[model samples]
Target: MNGMERISSFIDSYIEDDEGLLNEILSEAIKNRVPVIRKASKEFLRTQLLIKEPENILEIGTAVGYSSLYMSNYIKPNSKITTIELDEERANLALENIKKLGKEEVIRVIKGDACKVLKTLPDASYDFLFVDAAKGQYINYYEEIIRAAAKNAVIISDNVLQDGEILESHYTVEKRNRTIHDRMREYLYKITHDKRVCTSILSIGDGMTVTIKLSD
Candidate 1:
């Protein structure tokens, strides 16, 4: 492993593990090859919610309900999380998991394309928005995301670097990744340059972007 890997391993080593049903859900996701947030990213997100305690959380992806259920642990008892999943199977699995975990009241899984579902949401409805879906679609999701965000909303996007592909030249990357590479770069540029938010792109969990929508 290299320096960054060593650092990440060290950090993961120090972080606490999830217990009980949460741990079981995480294990199931891992066994089924679902890509939930990484250890570093999980801790980062948990801490973010603990600090912000947002009342309304919006998530772009709900893979087996791992991330949403995880976030539910950190937020206030009354806080609500609405997560979207494009895959019907995943959405159903997430809904099942939510029911099993007895989080039906706190977390809801919506089955549909996030791009369309986001349009249906009220403007300024969410205080914390988590984007963890199709990498190429992130740029496409940006406008609706901004419109759905509440003033001073905290927007957290995961996998922004596409596993270290963001820094590589288009010619160097594989053809399969070229589209995601280009779109991710554009997404980064757009969010960082936009005057409505203060964005910080960090090299955590495939890379994460933390943006705080400025109050108008």
Candidate 2:
């Protein structure tokens, strides 16, 4: 087997799950080669929704609408989600999945570049923002998410650890990934040190950082 195949096999062997559907989806993601949220990250965000019951949520990525539907499962029936995705093929697939899940009314998938689409949203409009799109654009997403978050709003950024790459020295990462790695480190530092936000980095799937806007 190839390197990634071997690695995935090893990881899967150690992964345990009590949630049947989640386990199924995760296995499907690996089998179908779809990118879905990791098990731990998904559960953590689900629990946060249970606690916050956000009136509105903005998701920067909608890969087959897995996470959005996952969030919908936890949120109140009346709450709404606006998710953005750039890939037409994946966007269509996400729409189909959301329809099957009977959450079309609650989750709206916008088709376009997330950064550009986010510009059209009114300021301070979302109670929660999830960043899970292109890794290189995390900082840009962070800026937009911060602008869109309402007072006390929470922003959850997934894959912050980049599979532990962030822990390596910059020179060790591939050239293409170095910039993103550095930028993510800077973003993580900013989020944790910024006085206007209370942030915690949790070692969930890959890694997740939760940030809540503090009072002005």
Candidate 3:
């Protein structure tokens, strides 16, 4: 393992939260080969939710509802999670899991395109946003995300680094991936340079960006 991997592994070794249903969900996801957040990412998200105590949370992806249910654990009981999933099968499965786990009361699964659904949301309503959907569409979603974010809202985006391929030359990437590569770079540049939010890109699992909105 490289230095960053070694450090991440070492830090993960100390984590032992007795996740009850969360563990079951994770196991089911693993069994089904469904993608979920990395352990380090989950912990980082948990820490942020605990500290922020956001009342309204918006999740751009709900693959089997793992991360939404996970986030529900750290937030106040009254806090609500609105997660969007574009895939019909995934959205249905996510709803099933949420209801089966008795988290339907706090979490709602929206079956639709986030690109369209985000535009319908009330402006400046959500205090916390977790984005883990399409890589190429991140730039498309950024404007609506900023519009939907409450003042000082916290936005966490996952899988921004494309498994470290982002550093490679554009011509080196396969033709099929070039579009996503270009868009992710654009998204990163905007996130880092945008005056509305202060962002820190961390070399976490698959890379992540933590950003805080300065205002509407």
Candidate 4:
């Protein structure tokens, strides 16, 4: 394996595997070709949640509730997760899964486009925000996320690297994907350069960026 792969494997080796229905959900997601967080990305997020212990979490994408339920495992008791999904089918499935897992009270699936839904949330409402929606809308979502985030909030954006495409020249990307590539680059630039947050881009999973908002 390559260096990063080797490191990921090593880290996963030490991390205990999830048990029971959670493990089953993850397997089912992978089997169905649903895009959930990578193992490495999950581990990274687990660590962050453990440290932050955020009471209110906002997630831009809820794909079958895999990440939401997975996060429910680590968050403090009585903590709340607000997740958005544009696809009605997926949102219904996610709500079903959340109920099945007995997390219906803890995780609420917002059925709507995140771009519009985010605007309705009260300002400074969330202590942690996770963005994993349509890559092209990341910049747009970022604007609302920042507005809704509390001071010192942690913001994690997944798939920022676009499977390593972010590092390549825009001309090198496929024509259909170039818009997403350019927008992702713009999102990365805006987050990293914004003085209110300190951001770190990591080459884990498809690639993830972690940002902590420093101001209101």
Name model 3 segments beyond 4 Å from true: none
lDDT string for model 2 (74-158, tens) is 8887899999999999899888877776788999999999989988898888998889998878877766677788999989999
Candidate RMSDs in Å, in order, are 1.0, 3.9, 1.4, 1.4
Worst lDDT 10-window in candidate 2: 17-26
Highest TM-score: give the candidate number: 1
Candidate 1 residues lying further than 4 Å off, grouped into runs, are none
On a 0 to 100 scale, what is the lDDT of residue 139 in model 2? Answer: 79
Q: Once superposed on the true structure, which residue ranges of model 2 sit more than 4 Å away at CA?
A: 1-28
TM-scores, one per candidate? 0.97, 0.87, 0.95, 0.95
The C-alpha stretches of model 4 lying farther than 4 A from their native spots are 1-3
* lDDT of each residue in 1-216, candidate 3, tens digit only: 988778888888987753677788789888999999988888889999999999999999899999998898899979999999999999998988898789978999889999999999999999999999999999999999999999999999999998888888999999889999999999999999999999999988889999999966
Per-residue lDDT of model 4, residues 1-216, tens digit only: 887678778877877777898888888888989888887788899899999999999999998999999999999998999999999988998988898899989999999999899999999989988999899999998878999999999999999998777788888888999999999999999999999899999987888999999986
Q: On a 0 to 100 scale, what is the lDDT of residue 75 in model 2?
A: 88
